[model samples]
Target: MSARFTRPGAGTPVPVRFPRIVREALDNGLRIWTIPYGAIPVATTTLVIARGTGDDPADRHGLASLTGDLLDEGAGDLDAIGVAEAFARLGTHLDIDVGPDAMTMSSAGLARQIERTLELLASVVRQPRLEAADFARIRELRVNRLRQLSRSAGTVADRAYVSAVFGDHAYGHGALGTTRALEATTVDDVRGFWAGHIGPAVATLIVVGDVVAVDVAAAARRVFDAWDATIGSSRIDRPVVAPDRRIHLVDRPGAAQSELRIGHLAPGRSTEDYHALVVLNAVLGGQFTSRINRRLREEQGITYGAHTSFDFRRAAGSFACETSVQSDATAGAVRDVIAELGRMREAAIAPEELAAASASLTRGYVRNFETAGQVARAATQLAVHGLPDDTFDRFVPAIEAIGADQVLDVARRHIRPDEATVVVVGDATVTAEALTAIDRPLQASAPEF
Candidate 1:
């Protein structure tokens, strides 16, 4: 064949072939999954608990996160620093994450040290010291962090946006919570939260690496089986979009730019059209070449970049197109964003656009399992969301098979431009009059700290 001058086009992506998981469980009901992956003699261990900020009591908004922070601050035979040092010695770090629906803590290192790693993870989760001094320090840090976030325009927009959308529902509050609730929280409250919420009955252990499933189960059992504590019931909230409370503007007074969060409540993580939503978002603004990003950033040059996400969680979620634009571009950007939303609902995507979005997702699917830590975390998602074990295995093929009509259908069903909640955190002097030009009513909102 003669040399071709034009660039080559991307071919069909090879579907990801997922490994079979070795699933086990302790008598206490803590499920264990072993995902054997990678050639390196390394592994990752993770414990995912089905309790989080959403489980916080009405008056105790930030308790779950507070409890998470207290873990590893002096456990079995080590203080927080010692716990950290031990993991460092193993060539890894202990990562604890508190999300809207679950709290997950993990560590990765040599598969040879997997047993010790499990022991350390056990100490942090099952027998955290939760000393009075450590509690005070973590509480102070949370307060300081909230105070700092209050001053951040983007953070302010997020807080007000969720508050306005979810109202007083459990999902309404931010993870860090307000200073009012934090100041009222005490160390005893923390201990009570731990006793009532953390247990084997509500958790799953996932180990992925170059190791045997049986050995991993044995090690995990010795460490996690004795966590016979009773886990308390979580708060049940049916969060819906707050009606008649449309545009919320939190004035920053003379700020140079405005942070805008536009959109409303969406389906939870386990929505039936999950694959379509992924491709739909990728085609919308999930990527650099998406419609909104292209119109706002590439064409008009109003902002540096624009993006959107379907923040799917356990029970409910939100769809938002977030962007920071100059003070003068605020109103135009708002209108442009809404127009794009309407366009997505009404328009059928071009063939090339659909192909690119599908490729973007399928081609990168296997990379998620490239590392032990990544594989362990991916497995944790299955446990947390109650998804089928074949979820990852089905991802590439399902995404590749998503046709233009499916995306159009989900877009029409989900994207609500008229019902979208518009929020701006910026200089009200210019934005107030500018945003008023839009159809929705503007209501001034303040960060609820």
Candidate 2:
């Protein structure tokens, strides 16, 4: 007997429901969230501290990032090698990430080793070695990396773009501080930053795996109970984005291509129009089949690729379009990008286009909960952004509910093509004549790295 197989047809996607999360707060003020998944005998833990580069002192721009790097280099009684061995013994690895709004220390291991993992994490957070030699070596490495970035056109353009858009705001500088600032950072400065920013009051511990939530919570209590309750200043004042549109050119002599960054301020992650913005962005430039890429790469043959994104932060974020093209074609590429942004706002999208964008977004949403670790990370982001616990459950419905009118409405309200700050990194001498069409006097400056 032979069996027949048929290709699956596209069906309406059912809403996704995440595993129930057990939430609790400890005596020391650490928020503990646990999700039990028995599909596999593994567990992942993430400790998110609500302190990041945005809190760096004005004079010490990379303080938050540097502090995160040194946490596991030597902590409690373990040296850097000792710390590595500890995780190796548990058959796992420790990962650290520093961003604009927070820093996270994460690890995944066998479910049976969850207790030992939490102990190691608590030591790294509460009892960092903060040794002088480790600090010196790490700072040198970071300074060297920053110097290398100065030679890359993409990096220079990105740094110049953010600085131009934000001005003196805290978000202006890159997480990697300026060369001068890194040079000035001292061991004492790093120690002070750790003492001030790290504490239970501003931290949350998230655990997800094939383990009991009650047991996990008890284990966390035993390890982190005595941790300090001191809270740091984590509030970010809303940045004042000046409505000034201008073309700023960074002179990168002898460059063959121009790196362009065009952007303006937009709503944050918690906006009510989040779903509409996502759909709009997909049609505009967020996807490979987006209008910007099709127009520039396929139709015009001007660049290899072009894309746009919203850097959604805890506060107001920026909408940016990035691309690289021949130095001679810089002005034309910029005009095309600006025109596309305007078209998204002014024109009515076709029903087929809207359907494609919606499907693209919702189809990918299922990947968020394919593993315990991903679920935990998603939950952590919800907490970070002050979103409701059921945000994931409603995600598909929200995307499905978006109409073309709503997407266009959000585009019109959020995107401001006329107020964009354009940063161009290219051979200024070769591109001078072509850039004159931008209608703004070019402000020339050396790369500030």
Candidate 2, residues 142-162, lDDT tens digits: the string is 989998999999999899888
Clashes in each model (backbone N, CA, C under 3 Å)? 0, 0
Cα lDDT of all candidates, in order?
0.88, 0.88
**Candidate 1 TM-score over all chains jointly:** 0.96
Residue 417, candidate 1: Cα error in Å is: 0.6
Tens-digit lDDT string for candidate 1 (81-120): 8999989999998988898899999887899999989988
lDDT for 370 in candidate 2 is: 85
TM-score of 2: 0.96
RMSD after CA superposition, every candidate: 1.9, 3.0
